[model samples]
Target: MIAVANLAWRSVLNRKNTALLTILTVAVSVVLLLGVERVRVQAKESFANTISGTDLIMGARSGNINLLLYSVFHIGNATNNVDWKTVKDIVGQPAVKWYIPISLGDSHRGFRVTGTTTTFFEQYRYGRKQLLSFQQGREFDALSDVVIGAEVARQLNYKLGDSIIIAHGLSDQSFTRHDDSPFEISGILNPTGTPIDRGVFVSLAAIDAIHEGWETGTKRATGAAFAKDYTNHEPTAVTAVFIGLKSRLQTFSLQRQINEYRFEPLSAIIPGLVLRELWSMMSVAEKTLLVVSGFVVFAGLLGMLSSLLTSLNERRREMAILRAVGARPHHIFLLLVSEAGLLTFCGIIVGILMLAVLLLFGVPILHAQYGLVVDVWHITEYELSMLAIVQAAGILIGCLPALSAYRQSLSDGMTIRV
Candidate 1:
């Protein structure tokens, strides 16, 4: 067996170019397979970790996905605004521990502007119950004060104390700008790698203050001076609210109560459950990617099979010489099988190395662009199992050429075909 293995090694080295190409083909396939799996797992993790510690997200009556998207992710416009009176009544519940009112429908240079209370800075939590902290300055205290996120500050070149004009609508180019109510950047939040990083936060009063005398979508000529006394100006409605309960056991009851509220139509959703639903909806795309990768791997294995079969005729004289020198037909069979196994092993190693190198450079880019943090060093059980399956399949594929070599050796005996 050892002699056959040594002969197989030498034979592959003799056809080094073809062997290397075959290995590279398998390696590429392995990279694609493993890369897709890694991204799928990490993307889900990032999505789930975007918001935590909040018991429920409450908004005007809408689909669970729509409420979550518009309220938490700032993805879409709200269908309707929750009455501020309803918000106060719900948050005043016995089970409610803290609440953050969210008022939207404004923008600052393409970044979503969120109107919330100072409690937002104190109560909002993310990944592992992490609290929001300031990288510079402090939370907004005054109506004219605005707190920008890390990404907002970085991308817009904003600094604490710099004045910014808020647009009336969410569009990047709004004609009706709130030029009268420019806000000063009072704080810059640390990056949370979530939608929070892209938000511009201000007091709810600020939201109403900016839209003073605005009727419908256009500003009316009130001719009155912009109200600087924000204490009197209050938001009559808000886009949504984030609520935390004193105990998680009461989550379902409160959700039911809020959903059945009589005064107005409303919806309450558990963030974790809604996130799971969103991920399940995306599972079809994930499965499609996996299937495509599997096919690539199959094609790679077939490439290896083709290489070995094509080399068989060229190595027939070598096999005959071995037979004359007392090598058995079974030895030729073992030699072909060992050659295939060796190529596959090398390919797997190269593929892992390639993936590691890619992650080393790709992780930062992904995090910067899409807020996805992929752990490169962690190797899951699934990956190890996949590699084992690939190796076994390679050995199985080798048997075809091995069997052919065995038959050729038996028939030719010590005769040199050429």
Candidate 2:
């Protein structure tokens, strides 16, 4: 076997350019397969970490995923707003350590505007208990002050004290703009590689203040909170509430109480479970990428096989010479298979290195674009398994030309085949 490997190595060196190109082809396939899998993994991690350190998320009775989507991530609108009275009642409970009331239904340049208290910046966490920190200035102390997310601030070219008008709805093109009460940019939040980077936050009173005259989602009458001199501005309702329990064990009990409340329909969900549910919804897209990458790997192996087979006729003279020098048919076969397997192993190594380098450079860009955070040097079990499967498939492909060479060497002993 050692002699066969040595011969195989020398033969591959003879056609070094072809061998290197074949290896490069396989390496590209490996990079694609691993890259797709890595992105899928990072996406799940980023999504799951979208909200953390909250024991339970309470929202108006709706799908658990829906509540999670609209409340924590600001992806969708609430079907029904949770009454401020109900939220206050929940917060007053002894089981609740602290709570942040979040009011939604406004926008600034297509980014969802959230209404919450200063406690939100202190208590809300993401990506491993990471608290919200300001990149510039400080939290919104005034009712009409808006704290822009990193993405919002960067994309909108907003600086501290820049007054911007809030749109009446989520669209940037909304005609019903809140021109009556423009909000000054108070602070910009540091990026957390989560949905928080895209949010625009303000005091809950500001939400009510802007829509003060507008009753029931229409233009009506009352003193706008932003325009007033800090009087009795009551927020009638909030979209959802983020709850931190006094005791982690009471999470289920509090969640049950919130879910079974008689005053209004409400749902309390564990953030982790809701995240799992969200990932389940996205599994199809991940699987689709995996399947496509798998096909690319298969095609890459076929390209390797074609390279070996195409060189077969050319190597008949080499095979005949080996046979003349007392090499057996099986020896000839082993040489070809060994050469192919070595090239494949090298390609896999090259691919992994390429992926690591690509990730090292690309992770920040991905976070900047989609808020997806990934570990550059981490390898998961799925990635290892994928490499194993590809290596096994390559070995099988390597056997194809090996068997053909074996047959050719056996029949042409002591003679050259044209």
Candidate 3:
């Protein structure tokens, strides 16, 4: 057995280029497989952390998931805004714990401008009810002051005291720009990997004030252009409101109450349900990526198997000599199998390292583009399962060439086959 194993090692070394090429191919495929798994899992983690603590989300009558996307994640626009009266009534309900009224319909560049209050800093929580903290500066005090999310501040390169003008609508190409009533950057929030990290927040009164001037076609004080006296104007409505229930058990009850109320039609959605629905929509694409990664691994393993078989033919003489030295065919088989297993193990290791390196550089870019925060360093059970699959596949497919080599060794006996 020892002699046969030694011979197997030498035979593989003699054809190092073919073995190394097969290893590299399998390694690269494994790397891709691992990378896809990491991304899928981390994307889910990032999404799950996007909104937390809010027991229910109440908005104007519309798609439940749509409201969650636009209001919670800043993904799209709200078609309608619920009347401020509806928001006030909901907040006044006995079952309600706290509420953060969000008004959306404006943008600075592509980033969303969210009309909110200083209560947002205290009531809003995420990633397991973690309160938002500032990285620099202070919260907005004046109506014309704005607090920027981390991504907004970083991407726009805005700093404390930097003035910015808001557009009339929720678009990057808005024709009506509030160039006169520019707001100063008062605060910058720390990165939370949530929509807050990609949005600009101001008081609800500020949104109303800016649009009021647009409605009259003249500033309030000067009755000419930009004016600051519109703060006294009444707000018509808000896009949506995030309601935090006093108790977890009150969620469904409060949601039902809001939906059945005689007030204007509104939609009350459980954030968890909307999140699940959103994930269900993404499941198909995620599964497709996993399937593609599986195919890549299969192709790589087939290549490795073929390479091992081809090299076995060249090592027939070497195996014959070992058989002449009293090595059993089973020993020869075991030796070949071990070498193949070793190659697979090495391939998997290289693949993991490759995935780590790629994600280290890719996380920030992905966050900046899609506001999806991916934790690169964390490994989930799903990824470990993928590695286990790769290892098992390598061992299983690797035995085919070993079986062929054992057959050749038995037949060749004492004679060397060229």
Candidate 4:
């Protein structure tokens, strides 16, 4: 078997240039197939890691997915806000460890504004209990002070002490700008590859103060000079409350309590459960992408098969030369099959190496644009299975050329075809 394999290798090397092109075609396909698979796995991982350590997300009664989308991902708007009294009542639960009351419905240059206390920095966790760290400066010291996420600061070119205006709503062209209540950047958060990287954080009191004197869909912002004291009238409502349980065992009990609260209709969800549900809803689209990639790989392999089949015609004399050396018909078949297997094997190797290189260069861009963190150091079982299937398909396709060469070597046997 080993000697037969060597003969196969030598024959392929004889047509090195053409073989190289075939290998490259297969390599590109492998890259696309594995690339899609990696993204699917990592996207789920990135989403799941965004809000770890929080036991329950309490918000106004609505679609569970909706509350999650607005409060954590900042992808949508909340239909209703939770009263501050309700937030306090939930926090007062004996099972509560700490809570961050978040108020929304505001924006700065298209990025959502998150209003919470300094405790937010300490309590909010992501990517495996990772704490939020400041890239520069410190937490906001006053209501006029704001903390920007890494993306917001970079994209908006904001730095410490840079003044920023808040809009009354989420739209970039909201028309109601809080020009009178400008905020100075106090801090910038380090990149977390989560929603935190895309938000602007401010003191909840500032949220109230900035919107001071506004009522009936009107904004009456107070001057920046006295706006720092706007906390005297704290916000009477918040969009959501992030809750951490005293212990993991009490999470379900507290969740049930929040869901059954009498003051106002409320919904409490486990971030992990919501995340699973979210992915389940999106599984069809994900599978569709996978199927598309599978066809890409098939097309690539078919290209290789065509090259192999075409080369057999040219190599018929070589096949007869092997026959002259006491090489049986099976040896001729193995030779052709081995060449096909070798081409695919090399292609898979090159494709994986290319993906690794891409990941090294793409980490920063992916984090900035998609909040996706891909691991280049590891390959999961699913990836291994995928590679195995591709390799097997390559060997199976090789049989097409193998039988052709076998019949040609027996019949032609050094005789030239006219």
Candidate 5:
């Protein structure tokens, strides 16, 4: 067995160029296969961990996905605002513990502006029930103060006390700007790898104070003084509300009551369930990517098979020499199989190194662009199973060429084919 392995190693080195190319092909395929799986798993984890400790997310009547997108993700505008009276009535229930009302529809240089109370900083939890912490300064205290997320602060180069003007709507180039009421950067949050990292938070009263004369979508030029006393300013409506229950057992009951409320059209959703439903809807695309990666791996294995089969013709005389030297027919088969196994094993090692380098550099980019935190060194059971399957397939593929070589050795024993 050792002699056959040594001979196989020498044979592969004799055609070093082709062997290297085949290894590279296999390595690239492995990288793609493993990379897709890693990202898929990490993305689901990031999505699920985006918001936690909140029992329910309530907003104007809309689909669960829509409510999640607008309220939690700040992805789109809400269909309608939940009246303050309705919001108060819902939070006043005996089952409710704490509630944070969020108002949207404002932007500052493409970053979303969220209007909520200081309770948001205290009550909002993410990633294993972690509370929000400031990286630079304290939370907003004055009406003109604003708290920016990590990405927002980094991208905008905002420092504490830098005043930023917010636009009237979500557009980066809005025609109506709230120039008269600029907000001072009071705090910057630590990176959470979630939508919170891209948001600009302010008091809900600030949302109302900025739109004092913009009832028609355009700010009126009236020389009205901007309200400084947030104590007197109150928001009449909000885009959505994040609710926490006194006891988790009352979550479903309150959800049912809110959904069936006759005073207003409302939708209440559990974040985890909606996220699961969203992932289910997106699973088709995920599976499609995985299938494409599988085909790529198959193509790489086929390339290896082609290389082995092509080398058989050139090595016909070599096989005759081995057979004349008292080597058995099974020895030739083992030699070929050993060569394929070595190539696959080496390719897997190289692929893992490549994946490590990729994750090392890609972690920051993914977190910055999509708020996805990918672990560099975590290998799941599924990935190990994939590697095992690839190894088995490679050895099986080598059988065809190995059998051909075995038969040639028998027919052309002790004689050169040429």
Candidate 6:
């Protein structure tokens, strides 16, 4: 058996380039397959963790999905702004616990500007209901001061006391500019792994002040941006609001009350429900990507099989010599199987190393852009199962050529075909 194994090793080494190419192909495919599965699991985890502790999100009369997309995910624009009076009424309701109003529709460069109250720092929670913490400086205290999210601060390189010019519209390139009424960066927040990380938050009054000079140039001359008397100015409107109920049971009742309010047409969405619905909608795309990745792995195994079969023909003379030296047919079969097993195991190891490098670099970018926090080190159950399946498939490929060699050894009897 030892002599037969040595001959197998020699045979593989003789055609080193072909074997190496086969291993490389298998390694790359396994890397791609495992990479996709890792992302799928982590991305779902990140999405679920983005917003927590918040009971529901209330906004203008629109679909629940739409409210989540604009208010929580910052994906799309809010079509209408709800009346501040209605928001106040909701705040005063018996079923209500706490509510934070968020006004949107402005931007500083490409980042979305979120007009929210100071209560957000106290109420808004993310990733296991963790509270917001400031990396540097304090929360927005003055009307003209703003607190930028972590990604916004890092991308824009903002610091405490730095004044930033906010654009009039939500787009990166807006014809209108609030370059006149730039807000000073009062604070920069720590990473939250939520849409808030990509958002620029400020007091609702700050948004009003920036746009106060627009349409009517009356305030532009005197620079009396904020109305000294709060009630004297046109009643402010906010884009959307997040509501937290005192009890889970009060959620539906509060949503109904907000929807039936005569003040204006509004929609109230349960954040968890909306998130689930969003995931459901994306299920098809996710499944399709996974299928394609699986096929790629299957193709790699097929290529490995073909490479081994082709090499078996060239190594026939070596096999004949081994058989002449009293090596049994079963020993020849074991030798072939061992070579395939070694090549596959090596490929899988290389694939895992490649995946590790990819995840290490990918985490920061994913967190920055999409607020998806991925843990690079942890390998889930699915990944482990996939690794096992890859090795099993490699063994099966080996068996195909191993069986053919067994047949040849039986037919050769002693020293026969080369």
TM-score list, all predictions: 0.89, 0.94, 0.86, 0.93, 0.89, 0.83
Give residue 218's lDDT in candidate 5 (0 to 100): 77
lDDT score for candidate 4 against the true structure: 0.87
Q: Over 4 Å off in model 6, which ranges?
A: 1-25, 171-175, 213-222, 226-235, 321-331, 353-373, 413-418
Model 1, 287-348: lDDT tens digits are: 89888999999999999999999989888888888888898888888989999999999999
lDDT of 2 by residue, 1-418 (tens): 8888888889888999999999998999999999988888777777788888999998988998888888887888898998888888888999999998898888887889898888999999987787989989999987878899898888878899999988888765545678768789889988888888889998887887777667666644434446576555558898889999889999999999999999999999999988998898888887899899999999999999999999999889889889889998999889989988888888999999999999889988987677677777778898999999988888889998999989998878556756
Give the winner by lDDT: 4 or 5. Answer: 5
Which pairs clash (backbone N, Cα, C closer than 3 Å) in model 4?
none
> Cα lDDT for residue 118, model 4?
85
Candidates 5 and 6: which is better by lDDT? Answer: 5
TM-score order of candidates, top first: 2, 4, 5, 1, 3, 6
True-vs-predicted CA distance for residue 143, candidate 4, Å: 1.1
Q: How many angstroms is residue 374 displaced in model 4 relative to the true structure, after the best TM-score fit?
A: 2.4
The lDDT of each candidate is 0.89, 0.86, 0.80, 0.87, 0.89, 0.80
Candidate 5: Cα lDDT at 59: 95
lDDT assessment of candidate 3 = 0.80
Q: State the lDDT of candidate 5 residue by residue for 116-140, as single tens digits.
A: 9999999999877889999899999
119-157 in candidate 3: lDDT tens per residue? 899988877678989989988888888999998988888
| Collision count for each candidate, in order | 0, 2, 0, 0, 0, 0
TM-score for predicted model 5 compared with the true structure: 0.89
Winner on TM-score (4 vs 6): 4
Model 1: clashing residue pairs? Answer: none
Which model is ahead, 2 or 5, in terms of TM-score? Answer: 2
Alpha carbon deviation, residue 352, candidate 2 (Å):
1.3
lDDT of 6 by residue, 1-418 (tens): 5765676677668778987888898899988998888778767766776788888788999988888999988878887988878888788987778888888887878888888878999989887788889989988877778899988888878889998877777654435666566688999888777778788887777777777657653225446554453333333678888888889998888888888878799999888878888998999988988999999999988999999898787667767777888778888889888778767877888888887888789878876566566666677787888888889888878999999988887766444654
